[model samples]
Target: MTVTNADRESLRHGKITERPLRDKPGYPSWAIKLVMAVTGLIFALFVIGHMAGNLKLYMPAHDGVAALDEYGAFLRTMGAPLFPYESILWVIRIVLLVALVAHIHGAITLISRSGKSRGKFRRTNLMGGMDSAATRSMIVTGVIILLFLLFHLADLTLGLSPAAPETFEHGAVHANMIATFSRWPVVLLYVIANLALFLHLFHGIKLAASDLGITGRRWRVVFSWLAALVPLIVVAGNIIMPLSVLFGWVS
Candidate 1:
């Protein structure tokens, strides 16, 4: 099709009458949502499961790694390794990996452009509606969360195996939780990370809602509240798990 002046005007207002979205780069809300929907559902479920697993701190033998290791074994036995749930968890894990990557990709793209679009008047002082803290510090907080995840997996999941003649001994989930969290340094790190995560969610989630086309009359507010609340709870919950141990609630 040949370009016409009329077609250009319509495209400027977000109409599909002349052009399709792929040819454009301005705030691909649909792409943001595609990333959100693809990743959001399963990651949400993981968040809940993660919280429950930490709650095992409230269990008996809650003093050391033994409790966590036991729970981990119980979970493994219950999942697809046993029958029904194993395949499901693996599929979810793959989906989660993709979603996380895509979500981050969309965010970076959007943020980078927003920076270019606002070049001169870009307020180093304060935003029109955005809080400066959130706008200024996303990269740092995100990197911390990424680092924490790696260390977490190494210490808990990878370190679970006992050092012997290649025997897979039961892990000490309880002891480990207690030991890891009870340490002042670890808890401090968690507290700082969770706080940053809280701020990130406060901004990113509402942006996600808008990106996902969930911005309705009242539904947006409801979801925005839930999004903020959910992260705070989980982040704080993780921090508290260790705090409890440190203060002798577990041990």
Candidate 2:
């Protein structure tokens, strides 16, 4: 049955005038969250795979390079045209790109609204900042990690010269990684990036857990610690492998 204009007006002035559920899952807020979670998990898998592959660096040079070569070959074979790596990694990347956009858009939206409602204010330094230092610091460190990730892709994914790449290194991914990480500067950058990564994850993981309805009072502290610890282990694994390469401990 169609409502008359009078009925429509009445509804609009009452229950129908209530605020929309933009804060709900899948509308905008929680949907971006789901995307973030999935992309994050996929990224974790990549981290694990990389760490395992880099474990080769813990071996002697000839042995390690040989091991790296084997892993690289395996990846290429699997990534060619159609394979799990092809669909999975590429899909993850694309989804992550989308998720990132959504996440950033939502953040900007919320932050802007917050600022508009609260009005502009100034803090001379973080010591005077309204929130905790870590929260303020997250933005800065997160930007650093973003920059590092872009540079990482340029050096490795784009196959730029790495001070030591044979002719076979054209399609040879692993050779380029070894050549790059063998440098102390690159390793140093990676170490700094990992520190930033830890900061991002330390705050982010807990935030995500809390948002996803896992906020039992008794369990929250435990989950928060686990959230922080897991990423520390993963990022530490990444940092150690590159350092191992340059220190002559591995290669």
Which run of 10 residues does model 2 get worst, by summed lDDT?
Answer: 162-171
Q: Per-residue lDDT for 9-97 in model 2, tens only? A: 77777846556644443445465566555555555556667667767644444654466666656655565665654465566568767
Query: How well is each residue in 175-233 modelled by candidate 1, as lDDT tens digits?
Result: 55555665677678778877776666666666566666776869887876876787778
TM-score for candidate 1: 0.71
Alpha-carbon runs more than 4 Å astray in model 2:
1-45, 59-65, 79-88, 121-131, 161-168
Model 1 stretches with alpha carbons more than 4 Å out: 1-29, 37-44, 61-70, 79-88, 120-132, 160-170
List of clashing residue pairs for candidate 2: 26-31
lDDT of predicted model 2: 0.65
lDDT of 2 at 198: 70
TM-score of each: 0.71, 0.69
